[model samples]
Target chain A: MAGRTARSERAAGTGEVLLAVAERLFAEHGVFAVSNRQISEAAGQGNNAAVGYHFGTKTDLLRAIVRRHAERIEALREEMLERTGDSASVRDWVAVLVRPGTQHLAELGSPTWYARFGAQLMTDPVLRELMVDETFGPTIRRTLEGLNRCLPELPLPVRLERADMARNLMVHMLAERERALAEGAHTARTSWHAYATGLIDALTGLWLAPVTTDG
Target chain B: MAGRTARSERAAGTGEVLLAVAERLFAEHGVFAVSNRQISEAAGQGNNAAVGYHFGTKTDLLRAIVRRHAERIEALREEMLERTGDSASVRDWVAVLVRPGTQHLAELGSPTWYARFGAQLMTDPVLRELMVDETFGPTIRRTLEGLNRCLPELPLPVRLERADMARNLMVHMLAERERALAEGAHTARTSWHAYATGLIDALTGLWLAPVTTDG
Candidate 1:
């Protein structure tokens, strides 16, 4: 029994290492550029098929990496939503939307790769649906509901469009800042918290922008 | 002399075909997923080294593709800037920033690949610099200058941050719409013109959003 438990623990450790290596490689190089064999090799596995053994497929591996970060991010969002319960302020709900990812990145410290990985996933045609399905949940839907309640009169199409624009802005901007910091380049905001504030402000305004009738 | 002229014309024709094929493949598959040999074969070149022989390297081929579209986009921007001379209204300057790309896309008709290609380029770390250096030109600088002049009160950092946010919004939003159209998915706006109007409204608000000092 003890031997079996140790073997399972070893397997779990190998899975964790593969996830980390895959995230960093996918972040630095394009996702399609890196192979599962490459990831297994980089993770120091004796077998070249370690990634395949631990994870069923490349998509499954990618999904695992996303799930690792997303679980924590969603928890943060849930806490923020609880605190922001029944608030009428768009900025408050916007904070609920933007702060979780930035705050999670902040807690993870510098040289993080999840943001960059997410940017690539969202940009890739086939991979984007996986990202959407994994990331958006009831918490996000509730955040949108709270935000929409704050603005009762916005056209449904406009709301949907702004939601997409806001998501793009948040994901890519976070990735941009993460890439800059990793490369030792200049960043506009001093910290992730301040960056979240900037995003929340701009996205708040984006949601409130008046819709034009004529093209 | 006549044979040499005919050879050069055929070379130019192959280059155009290579560019078109590369863009579409990169859009459909991830950029790094598609190889130069694949691009050459797809373009029906007799030799597999055709991409290397014609464009020198993948980066050079990418730049060539960007240049092909950017020249037309820049010309459109020039015409818009000429008509929008010295505009103080933020929306007018925003229109200058947004219209050129949308107008160019409209001219390309359905199933356009440039927006998706541009989105991938902007998201990739090594390739983003190429996209920015190719796309942001004298006209963009002049538009920003006019925009800054019209809003003299915004802090420089806030202005820069908002500019990045607006850019992320426009690039990814356009890519999203183009992807939807390519996949026969539903789109929020009816036409490229209306899409531009929607973007212009949101980006204008993004620029005009009030900055928060306390973070």
Candidate 2:
């Protein structure tokens, strides 16, 4: 029993190490550019087929990374949903969706390659469609349903139009933030928090303007 | 003089043919994935180096295609400015910027690759920055100046923020439209036109909202 426990702990440690190496390399060189051998080598395992032995393939490894990241996002979403009860406004819902992403990115000690990987995925139709369907589709659907309920006076098309616009704006801002960080804009002064707050406030105003009918 | 005219016309025709083929190939495969050989072969030019002969390199070819499209945009901007007559409403200016893009895409008859190219460019820092500097920089600056003069109550950051959001929304709409088209949706039924008009109206409302508060 002691030996089995020790082996399992070692296995968990190895898995963590593999993920750490994969995240950095994937972020730096993109999913297509990085190889399984490189992940193993970088992890200091020095085993030729370590990635396959563990994660199966490069594509699988990418999916794994995405899955791991999605869990964090899912948790954030759940927490936000819990905080935002039935009487939440459109602006409140927008805040819940946008804040978690920016906050998660801010808290990470090192800049991960996920953002770059994501940028590449935007151009790749297959991966792009899959990621959208899996990650954003359900979340957006739920958010929109909540928003529509909150703003029933707004036309369905109008609500969808605003939601789509807000979503695109968020995606573009995230990409822009990644570019700014990559270009050496000091995170201390121009933190993701400042950027996210500005963007969310602007987008929230845009999305909520239609329902308010004052605009 | 007749011979010179003939040669010039042939050169122009060749350039057109090369661009036509290059655009088709680039749309089918991405800019990085397609090769000069494929473009030349598809264009029915015997020499695989025909792309190089006519346009220097693949990057130059891509630039030429973008420049061709941009010329139409520039012309539209000039026409809009002329129509505005120095005292345009905020809505009028937004309409000027939004209408031309929607019309151009509708009329261009080119494959949706241009839209995809644009989506890729937005996420690409080098290309995005250059595009803002060269193509959009002067026009945006002038438009903002005009808007500020017309609507002085708005804050500078608010103006800049709305402008960025408008541009980002436009790009996203184009990309989404292309996807819809690919999925067999008719252009008339697509949400792009409605979305653009909605966005323009929203921005106009935002711009005019602060005025009402002061009054």
Model 2: how far residue B103 lies from native, Å: 2.1
**Model 1 stretches with alpha carbons more than 4 Å out:** A1-12, B1-12
lDDT of 2 by residue, B42-102 (tens): 7778888998998996667777887777778777677777777686877777767776666
Model 2 clash count equals 1
Q: What would the per-residue lDDT of candidate 1 be over residues A1-215, giving only the tens digit for each residue? A: 97796576477799997898899999998888899999999877989999999999999999999998999999999998878868459999999999999999999998899999999999998999999999998889999999999989999998999999989999999998999899998887889999999998899888888888863
lDDT of each: 0.90, 0.67
Global lDDT for candidate 1? Answer: 0.90
Q: How big is the positional error of residue A148 in model 1, measured in Å on the Cα after superposition?
A: 1.0
Stretch of 10 with least lDDT, candidate 1 chain A = A2-11
Q: By DockQ, who's the top model here?
A: 1
| TM-score: model 2, chain A | 0.78
Q: Alpha-carbon error at A70 in model 2, in Å? A: 1.7
Best by TM-score: 1
Q: What is the lDDT of residue B154 in candidate 2?
A: 73
Alpha carbon lDDT at A130, candidate 2: 53
